[model samples]
Target: MIKLPTVSLAAIGYEKFLWKNITELLKTGMLIIGIYYCRKIYKKLDDLQKKIDKGEQDKYDFQKKFEYSLDKIKATIDKGEQDKYKIKQEKDNIAQEKDNIALEKELNKEIEQLKKEIERKKAQFKSAWREIPLYADWRKEEFQTVKLTLDAATAHPALFLSEEGRIVTWQEPCQELPSSPERFVSIPCVLGQLYVSSGRYFWEVEVQDAHSWDLGVCRNNVARTGRVTMSPQNGFRVIRLYDGEYWGLTSPETSLTLKEKPCRVGVFLDYEAGDVSFYNMTDESHIYTFSKQAFYGGLRPLFRLWSSDSGPLVIVQVEENTTML
Candidate 1:
């Protein structure tokens, strides 16, 4: 408590006291205001920090979802491509199977055709080679060369006569032929215009094309209707090539083997000798002989075609001066 220059120490004591109290009050109020402001600012800062954290979390979630969606889309694309490849592969397999089936069917057809051809060749080889005496020209001269032609009057409905009635072909669907007693039925056949009851006659027939025919002599009074027996005992002295096999019309059909296939066949018929000899004129070789057989009535040159597949038989005419036939 020191005395001031203008006032006494005791007089200034109360003023100092008052000034000190007021100063203390201002300091306390300022400290409280500072604390309040600091607290509010800290609270606002904390709230702002929370919001930023939430936003970051949302961004992270969004990024993760985007990545997941990308991966899912990629997987879906891969699966789609795999399915497309599988479908294409299946289609290719089906096309290949169809091709295989078609190839197999074609191969089977070829195999069947080859087998048939092999069988046909085998039959030809079996009947190919035989050693026999060649007919002498003098013996051939003993027979008269008969110029014969097929008779249309005695032709079957299925037979077609052409080439000056020298060709007799087996026609399909038959022709509109007039019915007669001389016309053959149930069999495709034709008789010659001239009939021989006597004398030894020799004639050559051009039997071209596939062999399914009969050539020889038949009795004029043979059966015209129904199944006519072609045996020699049944009025038919014939030799036929049937189903690639040759047969002489005997009581029990004799099989004939030849060294060569003859396109032109020569038939020598002796009525009194009862000998009907067939010759392969193409090779000048004897085929088969119908020996020592009884003959009666007029015998005509018979041409029989077994089926529609049988080729035409052409009566050959030669200019050789032998006996008049």
Candidate 2:
């Protein structure tokens, strides 16, 4: 066998040292690369943490703003409820005031009506007292004479006429008079033959024993065939006597309280001046007057006797000199 060469110890040592240095250098390069990659990963992690913190802060600010807006809305809703309550209270007060004013007006109207009725009664009483015996004789000098006669054609069937148709008496049994359209059928009444249109006339009627009677002047076209109330609307202006009470025949009948009963009644008429006056002939005092009358046509004397009254209603004959007294 042939031996090649024998290695030296120094050469072997140098080769081992070279191998160790190469190993150390490779380890250092690997450590440097690891450090650079670790630093890059740390920077990325830090940036992600900052973004998370900012998101949390933004969420907190949004919650605070939402709470503030909700509080403002609650306050506005409370104020709106308060305003609605005030509006309802004001409307109720206005309605109550109108009702009170209407009630006051109705009360005033009733009071005024009562005053007028009182005044009318006062005037009636004053005229009635003037017909007393003390003042009766004093009014006799103002009398004027007028001749009057009853119209037989206008007399009721229950009435009997005498003294040239100047006297009328209510008979229980009806007379055998002809039924005429112008005659009074139910009431015991009569009309005068003479009618005065536009002149002053005066006449006297004697009702000494009569209980109830009506004496007046009526228009020529007054109702004569039926039962009629002696009123101004019916063309009859009169003084009525029934049940010991007297009344003036107006649209609404007015009561006339007399102090004394007159045996004879005097009637005076001024047609042009529209005046009809009555007087108590026995006492010669003024009784009542019909004023402000509208005389459209001829006016005739009208007389009515109650059904129960049996006494005669006579037209008294007045001498020209006695009427002037």
Candidate 3:
């Protein structure tokens, strides 16, 4: 309320003065009451706010402690999981080592057995009746040490001759002899030494026809190069007969005659449990072998025939002491 000037001050009567004093007293009383109540309410509110703030701080503290504990528990669990994994890996490594040891032992046994066979063959060298070249010059009987050559047999038919009267030659007049496994087998080498090592080999050939020419492991004759037949009816053939190189591996008890070309042909040895494996000599990556067959090498007068004509067969006397690189 606007403080109206006390109109009683201008009044000349005693009642006016009394009215002015009463108004002033009423205004003073209101001011005192308002101040007292306001102070009391503000204090009460301040106290209530302080209590709420304390409760919130306690909640925040509890939350922080709970979060810290959860983090610690997670870390412990992770560490335990890592420990378990480490233990498992160690166990696996131990098992693998044991397995490797066992495999090595088996390989050693096989090596020893092979050595014994080699020794026996060496002992029988002199007594063995092997076929030497019929030529007058003994040096002519030696088998040529083979090396890779750029010359490839012309893309003509492979001529073959049987021990029987039939003369087989590949050409326009001669119909390609039916590729029979029996016809293309390896003939035994009556003389000379055959050596081979076990390993992977890569075999690569550029041929017009894969079926016409049989390439794989073979035994006996140089003609067939001891190639394995490519069919279950026969077997997989890995022997290669072309320019001049001849290579193959023979297992024990299997007898074979490594004759020169023209006489190159397949011969069946009396190997009851002989095995001859053929591998790619260049890269040493592919392997072909007979599952169950007899293996033999001796001085028997067997010759390998390459072409059907006997003219191409060169009888060379191979020195036993010479080493092949």
Candidate No. with top TM-score: 1
What is the lDDT for 126 in model 2? 60
TM-scores, all candidates, are: 0.57, 0.56, 0.28
Give per-residue CA lDDT, model 2, range 1-325, as digits (tens). 4332224534556544453565676678778888778777877777777777787778888888888888888878877777666666665555666666777777778778888888888777766766455453444455456668899999888888895888988777787988788888766778998788876677889999787899989998877665777788888889988888888998788887655688999887778778787888766777778867668899999998887554778998876533442
Error of 2 at 281 (Å): 1.5
Q: Give stretches of model 2 more than 4 Å off.
A: 1-144, 321-325
Worst 10 residues of 2 by lDDT: 1-10
Candidate 3 lDDT score at position 295: 36
Q: Highest lDDT: give the candidate number.
A: 1
In order, how many clashes per candidate? 0, 3, 75
Model 3, span 236-265: residue lDDT tens: 223434344443322222232234232223
Candidate 1 lDDT, 186-227, residue by residue in tens: 778899987888888888899867579999989999999997
> What is the Å distance of residue 41 in model 3 from its true position?
5.9
Better of 1 and 3 by lDDT: 1
lDDT of 3: 0.39
* Per-model root-mean-square deviation over C-alphas: 18.0, 11.0, 19.6
